[model samples]
Structure formats: C-alpha cells, structure tokens
Target: MIGDSGAKSLSEGMTSMHELTHLDLSHNNIGHTGAERLSEVMRSMDGLMFLDLSLNKIGDNGAECLSEGMRSMHGLTHLDLSHINIEDSAAARLSDVMRSMDGLTHLDLSHNNIVDCGAKSLSEVMRSMHGLTHLDLSHNNIGDSGAKSLREGMRSMHGLTHLDISDNKIGDSGAESLSEVMRSMDGLTHLDLSHNNIGDSGA
Candidate 1:
C-alpha cells in the first residue's frame, strides 16, 4: 500500500525502467497532481502488464489523465482502479482508452460509483476485448436495468471466465437476464452475485 505518499516521492527521479511489468500503488492518496505526473512517466513504460491504483483519491480528472497515458501500454493485462471515485464520464474515458488494450484479461472497478451509463459503456467496449477473462464491478449502484444492459453487452464475451457483480442492486429480473446469458458463456467458471436482491426463482 503506497497510501499517503506524495506524488513527488513516488515519481521523483523515477526515470526509464522499461522492464517494469507490475506496479501496485493501492490506497495511495495520489490525487490529480500525482496521477498527472505519474501518467507522464507511465507513457514510456510500455512493458507494464499489471497496475493497481485502488483506494486512491484520483477522480475523473485523474482517470482521464491515466487513460491518455495508458494508450501506449498495449501489454497491460490486468488493471485495478476500485474506489477511485470514477463516475460515468470517467468510465467512458477509460473505456475508450481500453479499446487499445487488446491483451487486458483482468479488470477491477469495484466500489466506484459507476451506474447504468458507465456499466453499459464498459460492457459495449468489453465486447471488443476477446481476451478479457476476469472482471469485478462489485459494490457499485448498478440497478436491474444496468445489470440487464451488462448481460446484453457480455453475451459476446466467450472468453470471460470470472465475474463479480456482488452488492449491486440486482433483483430477480436482473438475475434472470444474467442467468440466461450465462448459458452461452461456456468459459465462465466463477461468478459472485452475493448481496443482491435475487430470490430462489432467479437463482
């Protein structure tokens, strides 16, 4: 956990180290300033495969900045931005940038405020990523409509194997929709829908 560390301390003198593949800066208090500065350096770290920035205070502005810098990180396979205060607009921006990340297989955006719009936008983009296998959108406020939209968008993701949408306000209707789609996803091995409103019928 790199929480509370100033941006200058994190990125200061951190020059080119192209071989770096994994970096975890979770719980960091790096807001817009740190995100901006780090993004500038990240542009050159093309070999980065995994990055975790969960629990950071970086909001939409920082997310936008990260999106711009991550455009060149084609090797990125896993990314975590949970609890970063990302909204629909920021999620859209991230989705746009994610189009370039064909190799991305795992993503975690749990605990954010992403609603129907954000989930729909992300689901649309996830269709283009055939390699994506793991996804976590738990603890958000996605309602039944958003869950249905996600079901529609995820229908084409044959490679997806793990999914976690727990604690989202998904009711029986949403669960039914998801269950229907799950029939087609042969690769799906793990699913977590705990803390939802699904009843026995939906199960």
Candidate 2:
C-alpha cells in the first residue's frame, strides 16, 4: 500500500499532468487527507473521464473531498469507489455532487457500509443521471425502504442497461419494489439480485 503520504505525493505530481484522462489508485492506503490533496488536482482535469479508487479505506471524510473534486470534472463518465468504507453520510455527500453529472455512464459502489439512508441518497441522485448505463450497489446493507427509494429513482433511468444490487439485506418487499421498477425500464439488459432474501412471491 502506498499510504496517504504516497497519495499526497502523487497528487502533487498529478497537478502537472493536464492531459490525463484516466486515474486509478486502487489498493492504495489513501484516506481523507490524501483524498483532499488529490481533489485539488482533480479540479484541474476537466477532461478526465475515468476515476477508480477501489479497495482503499477512504470513509465518509474522503467521500467529502472527492465530492468536491467531482464538481469540476464534468467529463467524467465512469466512477468506481467499491470497498472504501463509505457509509450513509459519504453516500449522501457523493450523491449531492453527482446530481450535475448527467453524462456519467457507469458508477460502482459495491461492498461498503451503505444502509437505507445511503441508498436513499444514491437513489435520489440517480434520478437525474439518465445517461447511466451501469450501476452497482451490491453487498451493502440496504433494506425495503431503500429498495423502494431506489425503485423510484430507477424510473427515470431509462438509459441504464445493467443494474446490480446483489448480496444486500433486501427481502420480499424490496424485491417487489425492484420488480415493479424493472417493468418500466425497457432498456435494462442485465439485473443481478442473487444472494439476497427474495422469495417466490417477489420473484
């Protein structure tokens, strides 16, 4: 792991690369402190389209910093933050920043501590990102209420083709809500709900 200090050093170097389009810092031990510095560099990369920071332990604090950076990267289309210890507050912060990025096509938030509150926040933000083609929120802690909220948001995601919410705490009620929403999402091509608590009635 490169750690926060390493990330800070890399961020300083990142500022000089104006033509960079892809940035992947997965598995680095970056936290809020490093994220804050990286964000400062991200603000200058308006042409950036891909950003991946998976497998790091950047909790809610890092999310806040990244959210602020996201504000300047309008060309970003794919964002991956899986297994970063993100919780409800972090999700809420990221959702607020994502609201303006309608051109974003793929978003991955799998394997985190997100609960119902976080799901609700992501759902609300999903409403405006009609261009989203892939969304992964699997292995979280979302339940019925969260599923219902996400279902409502999915109503407007007519352009989404792949959706994954597997390995969560969702049960029959949540499955039903998702089913209802899927009926209207004509563009949906793939759906993964495995490893959940869905029953025959919901299926």
Candidate 3:
C-alpha cells in the first residue's frame, strides 16, 4: 500500500536493508525519475529476490534504468512490472537484462500496452531462460503472429509450468499454434487463454 511515498524515501530506507529478500512497491506513483534513483540503490541489495513495481507510472525511460539495475541483481527470482507504461522498446531492453537473470522463475507484465513487437522481443530472450516457470502476459495486444513467435521461443523453456496470455486478441490460428506448443510442454500445468478469439475448432 506504499503508493505515493515518492522515491527519496525508498532510496533512503531500502538501501540500508541489505538482507532484504522481497520488496513490494505496487500502486506507487513513482515515475521515471524515481525509478531511476531507486534502481541505483537496488544494485547494492544482493539478497533481493522478489520485487513488485506494478501500477507505477514508469515508462520506457524508467524501464531502461531498471534494466540496468536488474543486470546486477543475479539473485532475483521473481519480478512484477504489471500495469506499468512499458512498451515494445522498453520490453526489449528488459529482455536483454533478463538474459542474465538465470535465476528468474516468475515474471508478470500484464495490463500494459505490449503488442506483437513487444511479445516478439520477449520471445527472443525467453528462449534462454530455462529456469522460468511462471509467466503472465495478459491484457496486451498480442495477436496470432506474436503467439506463433512465442510458441516457438517457449519451446526451450522446459521448466515453464504456468502461462497466461488471455485478453491478447489471439484468434483460432494463434490458439492452434499455442495448443500445439502446450502439448510439448510437459511441465506446464496452468494455462489461461480465456477472453481470446479462439473458436471451437482451435479450442
């Protein structure tokens, strides 16, 4: 519930907690400036494994700054950036950083404006994240092209067990492609493709 406490407070208080493992700053009004400053402090917290920055007003500038901070966070396992104003360019930058985060298992980027370009960028990097198990990309604009691309990229994620791509404008072709990929994912147990355009044949 620490929504509007600003970045100065976070930098001052969060930097001292070197042993902190999880930090949730969701619903905050923190923008690019605050995010940039907070990112600098987060680089020192080596024990940080989970971070939630959802509902922040962070855009591409903030996302790029955060990516820089995330590069040093090798121990990070779970990350949530949902409802942020991140787009395809920012997602690409984050994807580059994610390649180094081999420990990352869960990621949430829902409720944003990420479209086919963003999904394509994510798919390119997700191929190397073998430890990732849970991923949420719902409420975006990913279409059949993005779904097909993601299906191909996610084939390497053998550890992936949960996935959510609902409300992404996926049609029958996209669902067919995703279904085919799901059949090969032995670890996948949870999948959410509801609210899409898939027909009975694709279903």
Which candidate number has the best TM-score?
2
| Model 2 residue 54 distance off true place after TM-score fit, in angstroms | 0.7
Give TM per candidate.
0.92, 0.96, 0.93
TM accuracy, model 1: 0.92
Candidate 3 colliding pairs: none
lDDT per residue (tens digit) for residues 54-160 in model 2: 99988889888988988978888999999999999999999998887878999999999999999999889888888999999999999989999999888888888
Candidate 3 structure quality by residue, lDDT tens digits, 24-139: 88887888988888888888877889999999998889989989988878889999999999899999999998887889999999998888888889999888888999999999
Candidate 3 wrongly placed segments (more than 4 Å): 1-5
Supply every candidate's count of residue pairs whose N, Cα or C atoms clash at under 3 angstroms.
0, 0, 0
Q: Give the Cα error of residue 124 in candidate 3, in Å.
A: 1.2
lDDT for 126 (candidate 3) = 88
Cα lDDT, model 2, residue 139? 95
**Candidate order, TM-score descending:** 2, 3, 1
Predicted structure 2, TM vs. truth: 0.96
lDDT for 67 in candidate 3 is 91
